[model samples]
Target: MVGNRSCRIAASAGLFVVLAGTAGCGDEPATQIAAGSGTTTTSGAHWQRLPDAPLSPRASSVMVSSGTEVLVIGGQDTAPCPPGADCAPGRITRDGAALDLTTRTWRTIAPAPRPLLGEQAVVIDGVVHVLAQNHGPDGYDKPARLLSYDVATDQWREAAAPANSIGAALTSSGAKLLAYETSHEQGLVPDRILDGGTWRDLPRDPLAPSFDRVMVAVGDERLILFAHELVTNPGADKPSIVQAAEYDLAKQTWRRLPDSEIIGGWYWSHTDGLLVDPSIGGADGGQTGNYGRVYPEGGIFDPRARQWRPLPALPAEPSDDLWQGPATGGPELAIVRGFVLDPGAGKDGRWIRLPQPVRGAAEDPAAAWVGDRLVAFGGTVHTDRKSAFTADTWMWQQ
Candidate 1:
């Protein structure tokens, strides 16, 4: 998550922040929250613990949909060590398992053919697909492959790898899966889409090389590109030049969206037409943990309407660990701080805060919608020697 303090104050106008305790702008919910981070909701939206995961504790794994179950795939495990304990041997593993949401059980699937350090996964044609990855500091230079898991056959296979996949990303739209690297060679790599079983080049993105850029799938036929264009030449001294653009898939042309006027980073994720910066306040607070955190702030880009709404400042949070994604079970997007309802998704625009995961915080955890219950598991926290690995399973009821 990354951000800047400069935000348009009127971003949340006319939108209701439907939390229990306070109303930032619009009408408040009738249910009076009893505090404790809104952990217990009168509306039956609460957090609960599931059985401990059978899969090994890990982070940065591929968690994607597989028929009626949620599949957990390859990730690296860094065991939290004792104070000053040796932890130079943490390794990435290809192990995987499938969690049958109907029965809430796990069965080990065939391990990936290569190590799994991927952050994105999608299922195409009933097969689970993920990008293969390299590890440590040298991962940027090492070539990466594509891995697919055949659930029915319980087998794994490798495909042509993405060149310079360290900063690559994967997202699915309609029936097509896309892969692209944020940084390649001089600037960026041509965006690729999976056709049949092979990666095919799409059109070249229109933006010039920038310090940072990210693409987010808006809907079935549109992709939104957000970036910080690096300005050169004389008199180009502005601190920030945040940009947003849209690519119409049918026409295959890049059109510029309104300038967000905010610094951008890896924190952007979109769902249901809204691109959200999940965490903002503590992003640059300090070099240490989030003890320097302030209230949350981020920009929300609604490309469909050519609008940008600044996220309303929420109450002070203890930490700034937010995992944002589509709440496939409902019209809302889930962030650890709370859930955001998309006004266009048959619900009123609202923000609902919830309790932090009682379990220790882990970065890059895997979460997916299993019906109305959101299942999340497997992420790690390295305190002293990059040690603690979380095997705990947590679920949220929508």
Candidate 2:
């Protein structure tokens, strides 16, 4: 649990403080970037602790970087609720803040229009589009809403909402924003937002039904949808089946890829192909309660050849006890457990183990590639319970 130290900085004002020699801040730690025959590579990257964010301790916060500032949005905070009304233990916060990378300073931003939890934010053009979930006094069963924030103006606006209440998976293909949802009733149809407000379904062929799916953008105008369907019959041969297809935005059509042995799990897009870590729903495999495991091999998917190629196995095996704790990376590299793998660096790449944060190990924190560095912030620490929320922020740069 985080200590009760109040974040004393003024709201909506920049707090300038020299971060040198701050407690819990460390100098650049050593890193090894290696390249060889199908092995992990080492790099000279290290971690640096930024000044503490001027906000109460929280977790599950959505962090998005635009220009030189990184915005920290809605999250669940440990602060107690106001006295007179019935409320959940800890309240949801609509407050937000910004960290100026150029100046190494922190400033509070305008609070969100509404309180949201577990929402996802993506930058299209110069604005930040947040797919917000409306959890009123009743609870989180409410429909999801779309909200847009202008970083230049520090203003928020409500956009046209999706057709369904369930939130959609959001990603960008060039300047276009793609939102996909696998509904049992509506089937599989993806919506694209080109100008940032209106969303129209992409014209395509019928998609197969699946227990769950993962989508990633390939190149500037193509997307790959990986679907996994479970075998209902007890006497069936395999536990589940995995299928993939590519969508061409130019033609607005879907073409089924040749069936290959690829496991569908969390994946990050890379220059060569898609780097996949075959772990599901955190380290504890908690997503098994909803979407059962489909495939469990870490590999790469080449969109040009339409073939699946296996990469070297990850150094840290999937943990059965941690929830959503698999290694995650962006376009350039991947971090499994604490080890970093840069598959795109060719033969000069090797797996580099990251130094543990001064606070402790991060439990599935939200991270984003901001310019030349990766900024990670606010995740659970001790147990899977909500009380373990943390607000510590760390950065990794080569």
Candidate 3:
């Protein structure tokens, strides 16, 4: 669906940029845009709404930059109409759109070759590589669903699917894209590392629980997995503590880090963005696992000390305000978290929070850093109306 509308809402004081969408009026509908450009209104600690063509509402989708353009794909829209509250956001959309980041303009692109709901993608070597499974009412199953998009050619083609059928929460570390399938059914514990057209399965950490989790690439040689069990079962004592561990690809080993050692908040889906310490020489030295900081709830992890350290404080108070509703609403507001690592050590890395929640609902969010900017996508939410998702795209500029 295509839409066109604009409004210059107040950001800080008088600084107002154009916000085009089907929202900001009436009951306010969930809308998205792939195109538009404008000047910055407020200077610091503020998000100036960039001009953009309206996008159809989608939940749990993925968006990333290819060159100067932004690609948004796969999200369900839940807008209630005459058919009760369910008519608001419409339906799930597999279509994709391109927003020119430099020009601030929008253009609809070819739809995804296949329809995907809770899927994710990463860009490497100038190619947009996507890993996903088919989402049906029953659940997801393994299929050959790997694909890649050529930004230069404006075309979509096939890539290798994951080694198994069902998986969620995808991320990239160094040269490899990592993904895992969460299952309690049988002995099926699926995890794969895809690189240069190869898939390698690493051993699961015995301490790691079989629950929903987030996977992120920290530094060059390590992968971090934050595991969480939302609800305790019948015999469990209480809600379990969310656990974090770093995996070294070179050593093919997993090192579990104590919660007190890291300085970042536990992002839903364990979706903490990883920035490498540029000061370290090559990928061999410095803090090996995760050097970047975690946000909202401040903290850090020291690879050399083999321990976790707390950070300063959150910039905003934890409450439910309209503009600050992000903090309490769907997991969307939680997206903002303090990140540590810097690609170049010459530059100092500090803990900074994202402006929004990476996940739509309380579900974990998925994230990847392309260049200096961090790209986050997808996440589930349980609301009063019904369980929903989000495909909103955001870029964290350093």
The candidate, 1 or 3, that scores higher on TM-score is 1
What does candidate 2's lDDT look like per residue over 1-398, in tens digits? 11111121111111110112223545455355354334434456666878789877676677787767888887777743332334564677888888988898988888888785656677867788787876656545666677888888888997656677363767778878767664333344455554546677776433455535556787788888775543343113332334678888888788987654543344444533553543322211233232233334345666777876555444443232211233455556665444455555553345554554453443435566664476777765552333355667777775
* TM-score of every candidate: 0.73, 0.75, 0.59
TM-score of decoy 2: 0.75
lDDT of each: 0.57, 0.58, 0.44
Q: For residues 167-279, could you state the per-residue lDDT of candidate 3 as single tens digits? A: 44566766677767653334456688875667777787744444545565656787766554333341133223335677889999888777532212223222134221111
Candidate 2 residue 326 C-alpha distance from true site, Å: 4.9
Which parts of model 1 have CA positions greater than 4 angstroms off? 1-43, 81-89, 136-138, 184-186, 196-198, 232-241, 282-297, 316-331, 336-348, 359-364, 369-372, 380-387
> Cα RMSD for candidate 1?
8.4
Q: Point out the higher-scoring one by TM-score: 1 or 2.
A: 2
Give me the overall lDDT of model 1.
Answer: 0.57
Give the alpha carbon lDDT tens digit for every residue of 295-321 in model 1: 233466777588876654443342322
Q: Find the 10 residues in a row with the least total lDDT in model 3.
A: 1-10
Q: For every candidate structure, what is the RMSD over all alpha carbons to the true structure, in angstroms?
A: 8.4, 9.9, 12.9
Cα displacement (Å) at residue 185, model 1:
8.0
